[model samples]
Target chain A: MTARTGVAGFLGRVTAMIVKEYIQLTRDRVTFATMIMIPLLQLVLFGYAINTTPRHLPTAVFSHENSDVSRAILAALRNTAFFSFVREAQSVEEAEHLVRAGEVLFFVEIPAGFERSLRRGDRPQILVAADATDPVGTGNALAALSGVVASALVRERFVGAIAEEAQGREATSQDAFEIVQHRRYNPAGTSQLNIVPGLLGTILTMTMLIFTALSVTREIERGTMESLLAMPIHPVEIMLGKIVPYVMVGILQAVLILGAGIILFAVPVEGSVAVLSAATLLFITANLSIGYTFSTLAQNQLQAVQMSFMFFLPSILLSGFMFPFSGMPQWAQWIGEGLPLTHYLRMVRGILLKGSGLSDLVRDGAALFGLMLLAMGIAVARFRQTLD
Target chain B: MSERAAAPAGTGERSAADVAIAVEGLSKRFGANLVVDDLTMTVRRGQIYGFLGPNGSGKTTTIRMLCGLLTPDAGRGTCLGMDILTQGREIRAHVGYMTQRFSLYQDLSVKENLEFVARLYGVPKPEAAAQAALERLGLKGRGRQLAGELSGGWKQRLALGACILPGPDLLLLDEPTAGVDPQARREFWAQIHALAAEGLTVLVSTHYMDEAERCHEIAYIAYGRLLAQGTVANVIAASGLHTYTVDVKGEGPREASQRITDLSQKLSAALGVDMVAPFGTSLHISGRDAAALEAAIAPFRGEPHLVWRKDEPTLEDVFIDLMRGKDARR
Candidate 1:
């Protein structure tokens, strides 16, 4: 046989390496099933389980006046569905204590002469203070307060005006009341908009990390790496060969998640598919490279899997997939900036929810590219060419 | 096969074009353990070189160094006319190494494994090459079977087939027939000999003396040191040991084994009796000084139940003696 040379030989060797990995992956039934099942299972589980617009928040109300106006206002507050009046506070201090003790998420206070002042057209105010530690839980509820209170007072005045006309007395205007919404935290609230795209990054990071993380170490543990090293393949070629198959798997997972998000949860994609695909491909490669790095660094398959999880924990927690990205402290945001998932989360959310284009996602895309390069570099450098 | 003349041992003066592997002072250390001591050996092209050693004696390490699977901690060498240190990749491309353990992708089918090797070597028409290898291995019908499911002998056969699928210049087989049955081992040696006859060099390691006798050249290393390097006859002749076989007549297999053990212990303590080992119903007593050995065994020759006959020392006798000699020093 003549010596193998030139581009054809390289391609042949790389293709063989890739084809071998594909065959092994297909043969491992449990692993193959897991690759497809994880994304679908997570999408179904997290998609419906997470809700930002929370309801039935426990609340306590303290009213000094035992009048019809205070009763009607309290009833109206209950109708908003955001507050369930679980406790009736006897004093203002007790109401605040209930909110602080976490038994109630909201507290309401009405002054003693509020009804009389409103009847005299003096514009007396009613106070509503809310526990706002979780901004998303209280944002929309507080925004809906002013509208509900004014309409309830208007209805009350209309009924009173009809009675006064029959009794020969004049009814004053119903615009004599003011509602002070003292609730703090995010006023805009959150929507399903952030969740679906976050799921895409999260699910991709999890499965993609484990997939390539086990590739090299599994070969080592099985004793096949000795023969592999004896072959005519470069380390970079082997890394790419191992990663290429999982990149395809990653794409499949991304498609499964995004497709499910759009179809099942009505999560919109406001950006171009091309940009999303490009960004998704970069993010997937970045994750696969990290997994491959772990594979090369670990001594055995178990250690490889452990290393992958070690990296996965930080990627999931700090990437803002679980928490609000901007709401985190400075140190966490700095850490988040270094993770591929963090940038991918931003890119995906920007594309799907914010209608971000290529220019709008340049920084995030560049971060993803840089992360991919860094991981690939480390993996190739750590890859052992000889058994020694 | 006709007997061929033996090459002079350790000279390694063969020209560059004819020598496939010629290394000098190849040493390796694994942390505190010196796995392969300063060792020098050569393999002429188209000749089968056999390695003999006990477990952990550095046979595998030497083979790895030769094939570029390991770098010597302190040494320089050349394989296939390329520098072993700098040209590892080039040497690796030309060497087919079968490890002591079964190292193929077990989940892959036999044919897929072969095709993977073939493609990696850039063999034209990998499918045809793999098919031909399967046929040659007599595994054509089992081409689709998972490699892990194959029996030991068949796995060894398929491993050899995969190694040769790439048509490497030198095949470094580390104890290729370790657990194989005698019949399969004979067939494997036949294949190795056939490959050698076709001008392909083979370096194989094994424990069986019969297998070592079949090689054109052999090296015996114990404790990371080369104790013997020559042909079978040359190594035995160089040892200068005088041997005698004593058969102890007995009532049954158990009693005969007992008598042989008793005689071996008695003779082991006697003066000039360097080695006394039991093989089946006979005891082989050998010593380096021939006259002392003869006198030492003369008293036993006249015993009623024992019959003695002079014999040439076998390779196992020579190796055990070498191991004992080394053990005595440590």
Candidate 2:
């Protein structure tokens, strides 16, 4: 009878606590709005703003000769949806100027002897120059230009047997003229296949950190923390209790984002699903720990939110989420390496696109683990023992 | 230890084993200012101990140190037979401390607040404990109502209910009835006395003289010093104040008050008077010496505008005398 009573008593206490927490949660309108509104807002914003399969790239062409051959190539470029012909540049210098100024993403220049070479049974070379500042933009432009050139070669084969016969004397149809191209990642080149994996890091960082930062600070402002502190529960238990619910929320968001990436953008999960999920969970846990640490240092809910934004600003800018890590300066790369988000971004991208195994991601995993432990330890130690 | 363990109800007569809380040479200082200085007192088990002092007199600080919420800078004490410093958490587990301000969750229901407190203290069967606490505090049907929606009186009741839900052996109430209506304060005191009757030790700080009178023993602290400690009758007797009431008729009370003030100053030389303050249409004149008090009011006896009579000094008169003595020392 005593044992039964003890169990009943413990259960009663837990139930009462959960009910009280529910009452406070329902009353806190800001947390309620953040939990329901933020996810929906992120979904809509990310759905439209993020496009992995970049297409219909704007390109300009400069032709020194306005002959029928150059005109046919320009028409082929215009007919292809991949290359939207921006305008015709009068000279090679003008097209180069446009590429330098970033007005046109890529430019095609046909040399002066283009029509004479085709009639004389000699292959003509087409020079493709692109502004390689943004690797993604450069890669998409190169792919579109390659497609247009391949179709133009096939059209030349049917125009006249003399064009093919004169080209056969110097080389076979396969080696008539080569389209020399340069892309940033996968320079041997594939476009949408390279960037889809990197989007996971950006999505996780934005959602998980914002949620955890506000939850604890809101409890402090509403004066519910006093009741929580007065309980027999330890500080570590309280910290875990607050973080566990948010971890579940973060996982749900990850699943939805990954599902959408696969269905809409054709992003393939080339690596082990279990490994990817584990890495994602680790990254989310680390981000949430940072949020909890921010909560402990902040005096109010507004300050907590401001500190979260301070963390998020650096994560987006210096984590190499949108920009290439290798392209940045050495000092900038060092700064990026210091951020846990940068390591996570690399890990996710490496796993999804490169099919990297555990040995390849040992550094990123260890960095994230170290950061998570440090942040959670500080949060637990610094959380105020008294309500005051 | 046996004396300390005896419940307050059983110890009707004073005995060696009557102390509930005992401390000697208790002192606490904040920087240069002494917040609690050289205080010594003993409270019997089950006594309703009232702490009376003006603002900034360290009443709250003293209560906090007594309940183990704060450590005294210079003091050795025992609460419920345990050392105050070493056994603080153990003492805290058995003590219920209510701050002057409303510290309960405002957004939660009264029932929810009590349940949370019960869970905090690890009370057995918290819902049952909470229900019993609510019913005891006369808040039976208002369980579903939000604490924020309650009136000041109801909030006070809920706060009291939360504090007592754990069935603590000692209760420390710091101005628990402040801002409460008069009737609510009366009802609250009745509940406090009932708890004391059940062998619960209560230490309450209040500014009200009537509340001080309700306590089994009252301690008057002024400027961080324990000026007096005793029952109402004993404190008044120890104050050495001989008071006289002068009832003025057929004139405005303000004019009568002014006339009495004028007469009081004239007789001050012969009487060695402490204070002469007007209370409504009557003037209450007090002094330390009995012979001098009789002689000082002799002129007022012959006045046709007033009727004079000797009366016992009230708790307020003793408190005012204590305040004046403190100021005079300063």
Find the candidate with the highest DockQ and give its number: 1
What digit string (tens of lDDT, one per residue) describes model 1 on residues B84-115? Answer: 98988888888889999999989999999999
Model 2, span A1-388: residue lDDT tens: 0111355444544555555556676787886566555544555465556553355666778877888788877777666555667868998888888888877877888899887886665667778787777666555455556445545755855347765454344334333223222233343344334444555666567667776777678777765564354334456656665676666667877787677667765666768888899898899899888888888889887898889889888777888776667768999888888777899988887777667788889999999999899999999889876542
Q: After superposition, how far is residue A180 of candidate 2 from its true place, in Å?
A: 14
For model 1 the local lDDT of residue B147 reads: 97
Off by over 4 Å in 2: A1-19, A49-58, A64-83, A96-106, A110-233, A248-281, A329-340, A347-363, A386-388, B1-20, B23-34, B252-271, B289-296
Model 2 chain A lDDT-worst window of ten: A176-185
Best candidate per TM-score, number?
A: 1
User: Chain B TM-score of all predictions, in order?
Assistant: 0.96, 0.90
The CA lDDT of each predicted structure is 0.85, 0.74
In candidate 2, position A134 carries an lDDT of: 69
Model 1 CAPRI quality: medium
Report clash pairs, candidate 1.
Answer: none
> Per-prediction DockQ, in order?
0.65, 0.27
lDDT by residue for model 1 over A298-321, one digit each (tens)? 998899889988888888888988
